[model samples]
Target: MHTRFTRALVAVICCIVLVASCARLEVFATSTSNTKYSNLDSSKWNLVWSDEFSEDSVDTNKWSFTIGGGGFGNNEQQYYTDSTENAYIENGCLVLNAIQESNGEENYTSAKLSSTSSWTYGRYEFRAKLPGGTGLWPAIWMLPKDINVYGGEWPICGEIDIMEYMGSDRDTVLGTLHYGNPWVYNTGYYDINGSFEDDFHDFVLEWLPGEFRWYVDGNLYQIQQDWYSADSSGTYSYPAPFDQEFYLMLNLAVGGFFPGDPNPADWTSTKFYIDYVRVYEYGGDLTPDSGSSSTQTPNVNLLQNSDFTTDYAGWTTWSENGAVFSVADSTLKADIYTTLPNTWSTQFYQNVDVYSSTTYRVSFRAKSSVSRPITIGVEGVNNAALFNSTFTATPEWQMYTYDFSPSVSCSGAKLLFFLGNVDGSQNVEHTVYFDAYKLVYLDRKREYIFR
Candidate 1:
């Protein structure tokens, strides 16, 4: 018994020693990691590009100002110009200042500048702190180079706003991606909860094949994919406007569509400071992969199951006969399908927990036995419309996807894939086959653009 007591004491001592060693190692590792990339160590990042702002004044060689803007598209009240007084680098940071000095007839003056060169298929990032005022609107966004001459405009060329903030609320930043069938017609915004004035946060935009992601301070906030498709009206078709190259822009405007006019009685000096801008390219082909769900049902299978007789190969729908999964065409394939409307009532439908503020992409194979265009709507609990799209498939198979930016919160929204419009009316239903139905989330973290 004495020997057993000694052995127990030794074992307890050994465990304590092991725990202490682990704690020490963990502290050492963490300190080493933090010291290695102490924010200023741009060496960890391959300084592909930057505007150190070393010159005594703003360098015209690197940037040119956009002059004489009526409303810079935000119904903003400021007139933008290329003047040095409006923008320059002081203390080693580029400053886009918005002042209340009288300029022409306008009550406020600000600066808007852009890189003369255009970049495509690269990661773009900038570290900056925002200015404050009730009507101060500052943005670090990108516009496609072809927008000026090409047929595409706003959403068509695709607008990627890495970071945008209003002076009234200096604590929040907005990251957005604009694209789809109609150029500049659709817009998506994600509000990241953080303070912009407290410290500099890195804003990143990753542009790649078929997808774009926005990040703030290395945390992924939003993503957009499957950008363009054709509907019966053909109004939404904007030939992959974002697939091309775009240029970077920095502007601090006082009042417009978003911020309106500055309050003359309480006008203050608002400045947007940018420490650095970096752009990075994938070392190799890095395509976005499908997402996995950790918050949804544990036993839920993320795969699509269906049966259909139609040629639509890349859809997830069920037919009346033996359920068969199909994916003949490269672009079009079918995984699963069911004829049952209100699929939540059946066991075939999968339950997915989603936030109204979240964004997702759902794809599936779809083909109709009839030649008519079929309308499909996604409904969850409370029968809310998550997404809706209309498509006409040929005799061959074709895959279709409807992206969602939930307008409201949905926790137990079972994925309902069915025919007809959002109102469940105007049913031109005639046995549409669906296969390979899938729901994917786009989780992204912001990275330095020129990294």
Candidate 2:
């Protein structure tokens, strides 16, 4: 709909005057974060909305372009435009490409698209492959559907970063939330096994009452609950900023606060290919009892010798790759120096008896010398992890738990804690502490539901 005069005027505007910068990831390390959790099943949830991106053009009904050229809040260098050169559909995918040219203003050109619709709570999924190059920042994130709904700006309205990647770091992806006080929030890390740019992967965000979870290809990397928002009078609540509807946005920016600067040599017309996007409504069978405000007692503890006050009497340890295991009075020391190029190096386990067709919760206390990731799971007869996730270990002892339903009861079922996988640091040497393990049955009628 742009006329000849409008197009010519754009062509004669101006020139690039400055380079942009990105926010440093280091700033988030000091944020007020939350613990990890693993208890979601996409197969059990119902789809509420989806876009396969099978059409040959940008669907106007589903998405609208965020067109501009000024530093997009992050001092970014790209001028986002509506041109097909920057965005289009190809081979059943929505492609958002960042070019090393200008729109008579910024030094770079790219495309940004925002969903026309928004929702309150659902599992948001984006399956996409990224382009490679230093300083390339591709993000799939969300903002409050109505920023003024809370009567203020940004942090008060809340922000959710589903997946954020920097070309400078090819193997890591970050998921973060911004609410309450600025830059104070929760985040998760994704250490990919292969080049993320080489294949398509699913980046997901699960938002529910009092919780937020992030995952990459079904591997839950993070979950958060300790976030808040303040009102105009500075009064805050538990889930204010994030309890409202939010809309989604996708874009590839060049040179920003987090990714630093871009390398012009690596600019080869790469595209951010999105395979599809989906949002699901809650349809799980299990939920918490909502009959009364009074407290219901927790399920009785089913674990024995759980405190390790005696020793590793009911437990077993396995060291893989090049690692050594040692047990002192109360701690299990797994000194892992090396690992198989693509495998785990150490594991600590205990077998427990269980009743058939029952739901149980496993809880534990743990701490590690250095901040590292660990996987905990419950296995059946063949040691197949029926439930699992990666949680970070700090120097301080933290308590964690997960709930799962067993298909068949077994006497020799194993409960395991594993660390030092090939997907983690190649040269890992640390000790993790464990104590006070507990297991109990969760009421089948009691589930976590949004109020």
Candidate 3:
């Protein structure tokens, strides 16, 4: 009886070990198999715009600064100014300072910045680092420029609040859209929150066909659509007035609606810093494949495309100035002989599943023409997160691979190719050949375990 029991125990332990090993292997396979993608061409959009704060100072051509004391529609108690002392760029960021003192009519002086250019339907994002202190109100918002001329009202023109931080609550940021409505003070407010004053965060607004979505660091926080009703005579009208484009505004208002006036006894300077702002639009011609209904799975094959071969089967060639794309001995080459300082090297275009971030592998074939060092990198549309490599290409064609695993920390990432001075420096110029470019699936389990 004892011998039989021992044999049974041994069998059970062996089965458990086998199951654990299989589970680990499956995770590795999943991690390895997933592929991520993004569109390489940005020209399809009517406008791909951003405010990177690259200017030595704020550009008055693009943004206007509001001045003086007015009702400001919120009973706030700060004087806005366009003066260089109140607002400027330092250390690669826009600074909107709130300083307490007798300046003009108010006890505090700050900056109220706005964009004269407006858009109707698009995606908007701002990368910002905020300030925290008592009696400070910083906001990135939009309002219809011709509201009084066309609709004769505030909410009628529509308002989109991308991000706001009130003095009382430094940790929270809010996003709400105000439209022509009756139940809630001519507008309704929806908000999402994040810990401001700590690190940089991305505030996003996606305005699609009939609905709008708001996100803080790619997390959906609010949605507004034409589902509610409001009447014409300042009453309830279902499906409100959101069909128009709105102008963009940024300001640091002191006190009033939420953050209410600075305390004179414990006064210090507060700063609102913005890193970058970007906007993207739908071309309407490119239709995304939403996946198979029967299979209930995304088509992974659609996410993979590369143009490193001589034939250029999967890519559209983009050559400007002296840039050239041709093949030499089974290697795809981009030749550049530009005397023009502003000329861009050859770029390739591909459509990708940009909305999701799964594991991915992007590899390319390369060989050097000269003995100098070169750089290869990837950049997204209206983005600054660049993944780069500094390698001395050999005479023989060799493969180089890069894997992308996005954690929750990254804002947005995409695939791009470059072969020259990526930082826009005047010195870097090179000729190189590429071939056998491949984007493959990742085995996630093994990926994570190895990591």
lDDT of 1 by residue, 1-451 (tens): 0001113343343243323221110000011111111232223334456777777887777788877644543445676766777888878788888876766666677898889877777778788878767878888877777764334344434566766776776676665565533322212333446546666778887666655566667765444443453333443333355667778888887774345457655534477888877777655535333332434332233333333234432122332222233334332232223333432211123334456555566666656555435555555432447766666755566877666776765433446443423233323334445565566554433221210
Q: Is candidate 2 or candidate 3 better by TM-score?
A: 2
Ranking by lDDT: 2, 3, 1
- For each candidate in turn, the TM-score is 0.55, 0.59, 0.50
lDDT of 3: 0.55
Better of 1 and 2 by TM-score: 2
Per-candidate Cα RMSD to the true structure, in Å, reads 22.4, 14.3, 23.5
Candidate 3 positional error at 66, Å: 0.7
User: Best by lDDT, which number?
Assistant: 2
Model 1, position 332: C-alpha lDDT score? 28
Q: Is candidate 1 or 3 superior in TM-score?
A: 1
Residue 130, candidate 1: Cα error in Å is 0.4
